[model samples]
Target: MKFLFIAQRKLVILRNQDFKDINPERQIEITRHFGPIHIHPTSGECQGGSPSSR
Candidate 1:
C-alpha cells in the first residue's frame, strides 16, 4: 500500500451559503454535483454505496 499527503496552505470560506440551512437530502443532492461525499472509514457500515443518506 502507498500513502500520500499534501499540506494545504490555503482555504476558501463561503459565507451565507444556503447549503448550511438545507435538509440532508437537498444538501446531498447539491454536493453530488461537485463530487462524491466522503464517509469516514470508522463510521461503520452503510447499507447503500455511501452514508450520504440516512
Candidate 2:
C-alpha cells in the first residue's frame, strides 16, 4: 500500500534527476494518508519515498 507508493515515487526520482527536490520524509507522510499512487506534479512523478521503513 503505502510502501508500494513510496517505491513508485523512488523509481520515478531515480529516472528523473530533476525530481530530486522530492523530500523523502514528506513523501512518506503523504503515502501514509494517500497510499502509494499519490502523484506530485513538482517532481513530475508519483509521491513516494524510502521503502526501508527504517
Candidate 3:
C-alpha cells in the first residue's frame, strides 16, 4: 500500500512498508515513533556551497 506523508511542507510517497498488516491501534502507536522528515528545497542548482545557503 502507498502512504502519503507530509514532510517539510512537501508531499512524499511511501510504499510497501507492510502497513496494512498491522492493527489500527498499533498503527497509531507506530506512527508516533516516526520523526520529523526533512526534505531539501527544490529550487535552482547549487553551486560550490551548500544547497541550504541558496
Index of the highest-lDDT prediction: 1
What 10-residue stretch in candidate 1 is worst by lDDT?
1-10
What's the TM-score of each model vs. the native? 0.45, 0.27, 0.36
By the TM-score metric, which is better: model 2 or model 3? 3
**lDDT per residue (tens digit) for residues 1-54 in model 2:** 767987877542234445357677755655566445444456453346434433
Backbone clash pairs for candidate 1 read none
* Candidate 3 deviant stretches above 4 angstroms: 1-7, 10-12, 35-54
Task: Estimate, for each residue in 1-54, the C-alpha lDDT of model 1 and write its tens digit.
Answer: 112222253333457787655766676787667566777878775334455545
Q: In candidate 2, how many clashes are counted?
A: 1
Quick one: RMSD of model 2? 12.6
What residue runs in model 1 are displaced by over 4 Å at the alpha carbon?
1-12, 42-54
lDDT of each: 0.58, 0.52, 0.50
lDDT of 3 by residue, 1-54 (tens): 223346445555568688776764565556556653233676544334442332
